[model samples]
Target: MLTEVKNQIKVVFLSIKYSVMRELLNRFTFISNVIFMMLNNASMIIQWLVLFSLRENMGGYTFKEVLLLWGIASSTFGFSRFFFYKAFSLSSIINEGKLDSYIVQPKNILISIITSDISVSALGDLLYGYIMLVFYGLSIKSFLLFTYFIITGGIIIAAISVILNSLSFWFGNTDVIAETGNHLMTNFATYPDGIFKGIAKALLFTLIPVGISNYIPVHVIVNFDLNLFLINTTVCIFLIYFAFITFYTGLKRYSSSNLMSSKI
Candidate 1:
């Protein structure tokens, strides 16, 4: 079992490495995409700045906490896309029967499919996250904690995508649902969760899980809570397992396109 786990870890790194190499080959396009994405992400900060100047807080979040929220959201998104870009397009892949190539490979099918591509723009998001962190004032403990939250948050985001997209196996074409669900999660993640109330807030913590991805993490950062931290950790682990189980369960029903294509 240990050896199997080790092998899987190596395969993941190798897949990401090759994807990065492919992106690097088109240097100008890669650089431009990253820069443009970074600028786009940075632009939102201006709105936040203006709002903070007018009012002391939004949804109980001071400007600094809001900054951390953006940092967490962007970093979580960057981690998910940078490592598993295909997760976002799993619905399309399933509808088009693109799992054929992955089925032929010995690695984990879900991992293989999700890591097949790299997003250059995601690099910009990752960089922008760090820039926000610097603005938040860097400290060794905060940096390490932020990294931990990024990983856990990224896992939850990816797992949710997989679960939502896997519906294609049953519904034939679930592309719309997957896209809408993903967009909703991303949109909610950027805002202050405190602004939401009642059923909407309940949904974020449960069905949608944007709170787990960003809000709860931000709260933990601003004011640490052992119980909340443990809850977040447990939720991430459960979601990951749930994602794998759902994808593989649906895989049993996958209809291959049988189209000839290269794995890379």
Candidate 2:
């Protein structure tokens, strides 16, 4: 079992390494993509600055807390995009019958599919996240917690992506549902959870899951809580397990297009 796990980890790293290398072949383009993405994200800070100038708080989020929220939001987005951007297209891959190549691979099909591509621009989001962390209040503990949040939060995003996109198996095409869910997660993540109330807040926590992805992490990191950490991490683990179950269960329903394609 240990060896199997080790091999799987090896495959994951190797996949990411090669994908990154392929993108790095054009170093100038790669750097430009990262820079532009960071700049785009940074531009939004201007709006917040203007708003905070007018009043003390927006939805109970101080400027610092909002910055923290952005850090968590961007990091999770970056982590998922940089590492598993292909998950975003699960709908197309399924609906268009593009899983043939992945199905033939010896490595786990989901892993193979997700790690097949890398997003250079997303590196910016990841970097911006770390940068936000520094502005929020950098400490050994805070840094560790922030990193933890990115990984677990990224997984939550990916798992949710898989869960929503996996619906393509039952329904002919679920691209709209998948895209809507993605937007909801990304958009809602940037704001303070305190702003959302009643049904909206409930949806974020349960249906959309932006709460587990960013809100809970931000809140806990701002003020660490042992029990919350355990509970949050536990939910993330469950999501990971559920994502795999969902994909494979849907895989069983996959009708191969037999479309000839190459992975190299």
Candidate 3:
């Protein structure tokens, strides 16, 4: 068992090393991703500043609270784009017959498909998010609660990305769905989930649960409530496991172009 665990660790490290070298060789793509990410982050920051300046608080959250949420959200978003940008782009692989070569390779096809593209722009978001989280984290008294929220929040973020990427197997044209999901997550992560009411809150907590992922959990963590914190943490883990199971199930029926029949 220990030997198997060590082997898995070696595989993960090898994967990381391969990805780093590939990016080094593809400097042009890396540079482009960074430049585009900077522009995207600058735009988001500008909007956040404008909104904060215009109101004392948007939906009961002060500027600081909004910043905290953005920090958590952006950090998760950056991590997802950095790691799963390849998975999120599975539609292109299916369309271009990239999966043909992937299937023949001995490595895990899904991992290869996911690692093919890395978004370097996410670094900018991560940098700024770290700044925000540190600033807020220092002011907050309950360090343990804050830590729990951050960890669970990360799980939720990863769950969202994996769940959407898994859908590509069925939809085939999942770019639209992925884009909409990105928008919803970004918006939901930037504010307090309490702003939502009734069915809206339920939707945010369930189907498009970006609300519960970051904001709601953070809220409970700040209040130092043990029950809510545990519940949120449990939900985050459930979502993560659920995403993996769902994707694996879908993979069972994942057919390639070779399986398609020619029209008469």
Q: What lDDT would each prediction earn against the true structure?
A: 0.89, 0.89, 0.66
Q: All candidates' TM-scores?
A: 0.96, 0.96, 0.76
Put down candidate 2 lDDT per residue, 128-197, tens digits, no spaces. 9999999999999989999998999998998888888989999978879988888988988998888889
Order of models, best TM-score first: 1, 2, 3
Candidate 2 regions off by >4 Å?
none
Clashing residue pairs in candidate 1 are none
Clashing pairs in 2: none
| Candidate 1 lDDT trough over 10 residues, lowest sum | 255-264
Tens digit of per-residue lDDT, candidate 1, span 1-264: 898879988988898898889989999999999999989998999999999999998999988888889999999999999988999899889988888867887878899888878788998987888788888878887798899999999889889999999999989888788888888889998899879999999999999999988998888877889988998999999999999999999989988887766656
- Residues 184-264, candidate 3: write the lDDT tens digits: 877777767757899988888787877666776567645666677667878887987887786677676676665553211
Quote the lDDT for 10 in model 3.
65
- TM-score between model 1 and native: 0.96
